[model samples]
Target: MEAESREAGPSAALMSAIVTEHFVLQSAAGTTVSEALGRSSLYLSALSSSLIALGFASQTPGLLLPFAAAALPTVFVLGVFTMVRLVGTGVQNVLYLSSISRIRGYYRTLDPEAARYFARWGAGEGETDDALGSLAVQGGPMAGLFTAASMIAIINGVLAGVCLALLTYYVVTDHHLPAALAVGLFAAATSLTVFFRYQHRRYLKVQQ
Candidate 1:
């Protein structure tokens, strides 16, 4: 009974996110909102799974207590808040781009003073302007944000899959739960450290 109830946690979170996304998309305009909904739905699913896993893992006599207090809101806030920020940033960028007449014109060579201001030493704004300016002008930020959200979704799904595999091992060969914990922790660590940071870190590295 505890296991069965705990299993419902992720499912509830998933349904909540999907409904929320659907409503948000209905009111928002442009591709950013659509992309955001897509990304949110994916992240929500992953977090929901994690929520369910954690809840079930805690399978005490009263599983719903843990899920209500801990699991559901954690997944909801993490997924929704990030999506909201990304979408807001995307909309602001679109508005900024709309202000300028010629994106190409903005590429006018960066003055030495401006280079010092931006600390873009040896970096060419004539080329980078279009790319980076997209943060304020084009959909580049949205695209990049989507990529990050997608990577997170993939990471969670992979972790869940690893857990399933470990469970299979335990059932098939009677291995202890330690095997599952080790594999699950390894995947969690990699997901948190690698996939979460990969894009942002790589971007900074490239800039430097």
Candidate 2:
């Protein structure tokens, strides 16, 4: 049995190393996702703030309305893009979490003794590893309310509101029926966008 034991020892060590590597890779990936989410949020916030400042400095409300109208569609598109990115980031989080759980299961299979390490404090109900998992791989704005998806949603909502208000003001000042109708249409469009977007996200979740 000595020869058989020697062969099995190397195989077991190799399997342990592979499992460790998988865990480390998932951890690293989670860190990268956190970083990207943070950077994207900052960039979008800065850009929107700068544009608002510029619009005000121009000191021409009439001209500003036109420009804001032109920019409205682009802002809406960007918000949608941010939402897509957020969905991807969320998926990554789930995948990493699933991988980690599988690894934990594998550990339990290999050595039942390791189960205590994952226990949750006094419960010993197999919750220790969960506490470890709760530790942040990366923390900052990404972990907070200032995520890219949220920022973009806020910016887009503000833009839609401003555009509608400006259009209404222009209609009142110029007494133009076409402009008034356009304002109504814009309001409808904004409402539809928000409603449909929520529905779409819900659909995606259901699909998953």
Candidate 3:
């Protein structure tokens, strides 16, 4: 009985440690999500306020150009910073989830009977593979575009195009509306493509 108790002691301590670690990872994941949402809210609020101010400025005749010249660039830059941090938080959350999944795998090993309870939890044949496979099927290829970070990116891209259009109208093309529109559309498309590609690469890096 003494020898049996000695063997059990270490196993019990290890399981306790595992449980604590699992809880910590879950908490960290939640924190990352919260941070992402908060940052997104901040950015969106700023963008909306700037737009409203611009709307008012447009009514003042000569104030429109000067106001947009200052406001659009500032808001666009803020959007860039916000989008980048959002992507970081998203990646961090994924990593935390991956760690939690690994810990759950340990739980299954300790109690084979408990595996049934975890079957729906994305354990799959291995720790991460099946979970990712299931996610891919459910989310599809365009799922990344639906994230908060992607939403910000799209808005930022449009802002960039608008800025370029204004510049073209006032400076480059000398108030040619058609030329400004063409340039703006091209800028918007290019910006979106670059943002989407960057996001895809970041996610792929996380998976690797």
Candidate 4:
């Protein structure tokens, strides 16, 4: 009996350690999500306030151009910062969840009978089994575009387009509205494409 206890002791201690690590990872994952939401909210709030101020500026003659020139660039930079941090937090959360899933797999190994109670970790190894994963698979490539980070990217892209349009109107195109519009649209589309590509590359790196 004493020999049996000694042999079991290491296994029990290992299991305990694994369980503790699982809990820590779960908490950390939650924190990453919270941080992502917080950062997004901050960016959106700033955007909203900037738009309101611009609206007021628009009502005043001569103030619109100067105010927009000052505000838009600042807002765009803030959006960039926010989007980067959000992506980081998002990736961090995924990694944490993956670790937790792996720990759950270990748990299943220890208690095969309890396997039925644990949720499937993913569609396959390395893939997350969460709602995001489901959306990505079912919704296809466009599904990846629906994330908070993407939303910010789109908004920032539009802001970039607007900035470029304004510059074209005031300087490049000599106030030619059509030319400005075309330039703006091009800028916005290019910015969005670049942002999406960057995000895809980051995720691919994470997967690797």
For candidate 1, what is the TM-score? 0.35
Q: Report the C-alpha lDDT of model 4 over 94-191, residue by residue, as the tens digit.
A: 67876777776666665558688775644655535442453344223443576779989999999999999998998797889999999999999998
Instruction: Please give each candidate's TM-score.
Output: 0.35, 0.58, 0.87, 0.87
**C-alpha RMSD for every candidate:** 20.2, 7.2, 3.1, 3.0
Residue ranges of candidate 3 with Cα displaced over 4 Å: 1-10, 120-143
Candidates by lDDT, descending order: 3, 4, 2, 1
Q: Give the backbone clash total of model 1.
A: 1
Model 4: weakest 10-residue lDDT segment is: 131-140
The Cα local distance difference test for each model comes to 0.48, 0.55, 0.79, 0.79
The true-versus-predicted C-alpha distance at residue 90 of model 2, in Å, is 1.2
Give me the runs in candidate 4 sitting further than 4 Å from their true place. 1-10, 127-143
Greater lDDT among 1 and 3 belongs to 3
Clash pairs detected, candidate 2: 118-128, 118-129, 119-127, 119-128, 120-127, 120-128
* Candidate 1 lDDT by residue in tens digits, 88-130: 5444433433333122232222243443333321123433344
**Where in model 2 is the C-alpha error above 4 Å?**
1-10, 13-17, 20-24, 120-151, 171-208
